[model samples]
Target: MPDGNGTFVKDFFIVGFPGLHSTYYFLVSAVLCLVYIFILIANGMFLFMFATNKCLHKPMYFIYINLVLSDVLFSTSTLPKIIARYLFQDGTISFSACFFQMYLVHYFGAVSSYTLAIMAIDRYIAVCYPFGYHAIMSNRNTLILSIVIWVFSHPISIMMVVRAFPLPYCGTNTIIHCYCDHVSITRLACTDRAPYSFPAFVFAMVILLGSLAIIVFSYSFIIFAVLQISSTHGRLKTFSTCSSQLIIIALFFLPRCFNYLAANVGITFNANLQIVIILLYSLLPPMINPLLYSLKTEEVKKILISKLKKHQVHLTVLS
Candidate 1:
């Protein structure tokens, strides 16, 4: 029987890992709790630094701030409930809440994809047209672009959720993966899901490959520009500037592309293996990004050292 809201199933169960032994639940939950804590402390520190430090207000940092926000919000939306599930053996989520989580998962994902593309653009301009880089990628323009990325990411994500949410999910109410997402939720639809699934797949590919194409194109130009530089040191310096972004990009995008492609194609993965891969790509980047920025970017590194020195002095004075 359908509820007043027309959902046949009023809630869904999020099974973190179907095969896990009961004895190890506490261990798994504790590890996840630590990861969540690290993500917050790392990203929150970067956010605080950016907010207080005006010298950090450049186009690249502006784009990074957007990425940081998306990373934090995404982690927040997904981590708590899953942690609770393992900690308390409670995996239940209400109908509306499940869909809301799905929306946020996709929304932040889309934002991250676009932000990475914008990051590539920032680097492309910096490397290829050094003289005009500042003029082209001014703070105001970068902020506007960040706003546009956030605004534009909503439509398709909302449509994916809206299209999938109203479907008849009268079958099993257990979501197989760690978090609520479109595919996991829609798999339970009572009706044939081909029509719905295909469109969602297309939208996902467009977001992933579209942004990926931009990154690829921009880096192609950057490579050409770097090669033309006469001095090895000049080329090395330029490449070093991009190394962190490239590392983050590879971590975030490559595994995701492989997973999406593998699923759509005939290749199959073990259920646990698939879930682990998803977690690797989804969670690792956010945890690693702050460290990458602090270590790789010279300005950020210098400022961080300065702040640490000041803190040390304050501690010494207090003692």
Candidate 2:
């Protein structure tokens, strides 16, 4: 359906996995629904703790709140439609709606990347410059940095959408991925997408590599500082503190770097395999972040344990 401007304004169908059979739609939807529920519950609990517990209001946790919000919002933007796509066999998304999702998907991704970088910086300061960490990563300064991250991520994502949205989409309206993104949607454009895609590819690489470089730089110093510890126990303890973050960094960045590079460098993957890779990198971090990053911390654990004991006491009285 073309509006008065003669541009085609039509809904696009999201083909989740080209190789997935309709018979397994219900099963897949159920599994995704469970994952979505878990993400909400886990992240939601951490958010609640952050809100109520003043002890968790350090610069590090302040930065983590952004990651939590980004994760939940990203999952919200993507999961429902795909869940419906599988559960009800309805994958149609209006043109405007699809582009909106594309913006959010990319925006949140960039936010998470930068947030991780910022977290690495926080750890670097804590480990390498413990005396000055408080002054440098103050509550106000951390808040400002988080604000910068949220605001700074917008332009490239908005430009990606702005550039790709106006292109003529005709004939084939099926998107071969779980969600609407610059690459998946722009590939549907009726004109030459090379010019548009090249810039987007560049932007994606810049975001990924730029943040990765920061993490690596920060951690290199952190590793050096940790190794300088006089005692083996001190070194082990310091390394333990950073191990969770290292795991998350690996999960979030490594796979995505591979996917992007693979797509551009003529490395081919089966459609289902590619989609699986995307979902793993995009979805897994948000789901596991609370457990690996926040809950594992001693402060958070002590808080959770004290609260649980209080709850148990209340239950006993009620009984």
Query: Which run of 10 residues does model 2 get worst, by summed lDDT?
Result: 1-10
Question: Could you say which candidate leads in lDDT?
Answer: 2
Model 2 sits at a Cα RMSD from the real structure of: 2.4
lDDT of 2 by residue, 1-319 (tens): 2233345648888999996888999999999999999999999999999999999989989998999999999999999999999999999999999999999999999999999999999999999999999999999999999999999999989999999998998757889999999988988888899899888889999999999999999999999999899999999999888898998899999998998888777798898989998999989999999997556698899988999999999999999
The C-alpha lDDT values of all candidates are 0.91, 0.92
Cα-based lDDT at residue 230, candidate 1 = 99
Q: Clashes in each model (backbone N, CA, C under 3 Å)?
A: 0, 0
Candidate 1 lDDT by residue in tens digits, 212-254: 9999999999999999989999999989999999999999889
Residue pairs with clashing backbones, model 1: none
Taking every candidate in turn, the Cα RMSD to the unseen true structure, in Å, is: 2.5, 2.4
